[model samples]
Target: MDAHLRELRYFVAAAEESTVTAAAARLFVSQPALSKQLRALERRLGFDLFDRGPRGLALTSQGSALLPVAREVLALWDRGYAEARAAAHPHQLVVGMQTAVGRDLQRPAVERFRARFPSWTVSLRLVGWDDPTAGLADGTSDVAFVWLPTAADLATRVLISEPRWVALPTAHPLADRAEIPFELLLDEPFVALPSAAGPLRDFWLAVADRPRPPVIAAEATAADEVLELVTAGVGIALLAEGNTDLYQRPGLTCRPVPNLPPAQLAVACRPDEPRKEVHHFITCVQP
Candidate 1:
């Protein structure tokens, strides 16, 4: 059974990444090699683990049942490993996030964090937007910063709550307006977050039961992509206030939308796993 630990690691990576090529890149192995290992693992277990579809990998029943058990085993192993190495080396903190944190917020925060924990190193991982928790629930990040309305299971700390705005092409009729009401933008098509973002997606769409309905022109998981689509006339979207600074392009214009409820930016972590390191980092970023 111990021999399968490596297989478990491979399986978990493949499952989390949802594609052989992506999992291989993360694991630092060739794509073909990763595919072979996955196939072998399936044969050894005598069942299919993933359903390869147009939408990418979806776990089979057996895979879903085995996932939590495998995570438990990995967590136990990691704890033991950390204990064994704590005396010999400095600790490392891995932070996961979906959006661009920007130099204004991250620079001072990281410098202060390093000064506070002089011996520790930090790794900022850009997790995809598919999981609203931004890797916190999966244990990939010690802590994560993401838009609010994440999974209820994870703990959260609100960093910033700002009014929403709309981004559209300069060619848009309302581009010259100083401020636009939320009602006016509802009937227009807009770029939206992927469905996997859960409530975060719904919140950004501002889908109230008004007569107007959301016409999603395209789905985007990153800010730059959404902005690009916006400028290309794909659609307009409601954006957080901070996005005005994060995305500044010649073809785009951002205007405050006075009526929509604001979005909150927050730091999230698993409630079951809290540490001083995470607490300190939170302090450094707090407004």
Candidate 2:
């Protein structure tokens, strides 16, 4: 019986970490979940992968033998997947974005890209905020329009740098102001991005600008959800200035926060990306 790629991945992680707890942490899954997958893989192979111990797990002889093979298989699969994407979709460049890049950037850039590569096409994928890289990490996007401070492995060029603004319900007292002081809104409950968003979440929460941690009213995974939450009076949220016009609704009001550092929107791609078309798209988006 053939083991699944996911099972092999789990096995490799478990073998390397030497403990289900460590493996789960490394994989961003629960211990029980990782343990269950490992047991399932063992059952499929009709052998135990690890010998349980009080201190930690020890790989069985079979497990140790299989570890390197599994690692090689996973590496080969990654290479094959990347190759397939390039070969199968050479003319289509996928651009992932978390929100509407409404600074009149998308249209002109895509037009320029199309003009440059007459045979090529662009696919704009709207990804959620949970993936701050906008699908670059997983190879779903050839290039992404992502907020600044993304993964270090990816390269970025800042296309838009604008002041961060606050979104509030129309009825909120702060909504009436033309501009709100950063400190004045510091105490209000804030709608935050998912913790999976990492540094991007902290940026939106103004974590560095605050005296203490923000009081998170709720977590939102998308720009629309954040706007909806603010409109429903769940909590206020911070946004890039370019998004204000795109997300504007009757019940939501946006006010600039002059003291806060501006949010930067960039075109990001894997630094090692082989496709010249991807780099061309980045150049098209550059200010």
Candidate 3:
């Protein structure tokens, strides 16, 4: 049986928002109308897509399984639409990165893209944590070096898995240790990302299973702030192990966490507005 693309789109939106009312607002439809369409789609598919409960709508196993397929279909369509738009008019491709991207693993790929599209000018923008996606939402940059768990709407290609390391003040008791346990950090006051970061803030806080709130001594938007705060004894911060040398202070030291997983570094772009230059850049970065 052929599935309606609109239905799949609505279902995915609802799943991502986790509330029909929110999904309705996002899709610019009335709640009752959206609900009716969802019901109709479920019947057509012969499966219950979500578990409606007091907390909100939770995806069933079937719905979770369908999510990636839906995203892939949408992504391919979006890429085609972007390619068409780029073909009609020439435009600059602005790339943003949090650090000096000269040493980036994708440099070789970028060189190849330049050889193929010599007429396109690729400009690089230095971005801070203030806007991790480097203005992808507002079109400041066509694409960016971003961390994952970003705005769910952006499509990305992961570049590296540089794991997290904790920076401790030299005077602190744990500074002498070669490594620290993740559990030890549970009790310490931590430096946090800006509140505007939303889900990103929570991810940096490592709050997935935190029962009680944490003590936040400071908020950092860049490596300098992270070092300044940690050195002044304001709070400790977790950062990529590779960045340890970048932010070292006279009174600061870095050590790995025994059990925490690595953080993903990636190149991100708006899936809905992929530019040809961005597509070529993504192609260069892809392994």
The C-alpha RMSD in Å for every predicted model, in order, reads: 5.7, 5.3, 8.1
> What C-alpha lDDT values do all the predictions have?
0.79, 0.86, 0.75
Clash pairs, model 1 backbone:
none
Residue 179 error for model 1, in Å? Answer: 1.1
Residue pair clashes in candidate 2: none
lDDT of 2 by residue, 1-287 (tens): 89898898888878766878767754668999988888888988999989999978898899889998998898667656766887898899889999988777888889999999999988999999877888876678888989987644688888878999999999999888999999998889999987567678889999999998899999888999999999999999999887888988989999999889899998998877888888988888747
TM-score of each: 0.70, 0.78, 0.65
Candidate 2 minimal-lDDT segment of 10 residues: 74-83
Residue pairs in clash, model 3: none
Worst 10 residues of 3 by lDDT: 98-107
Relative to the unseen true structure, what is the C-alpha lDDT of residue 65 in candidate 1, on a scale of 0 to 100?
92
Tell me how far candidate 3 lies from the true structure as C-alpha RMSD in angstroms: 8.1
Runs with alpha carbons beyond 4 Å of true place in candidate 1: 1-90, 209-212
Off by over 4 Å in 3: 1-91, 99-103, 209-211
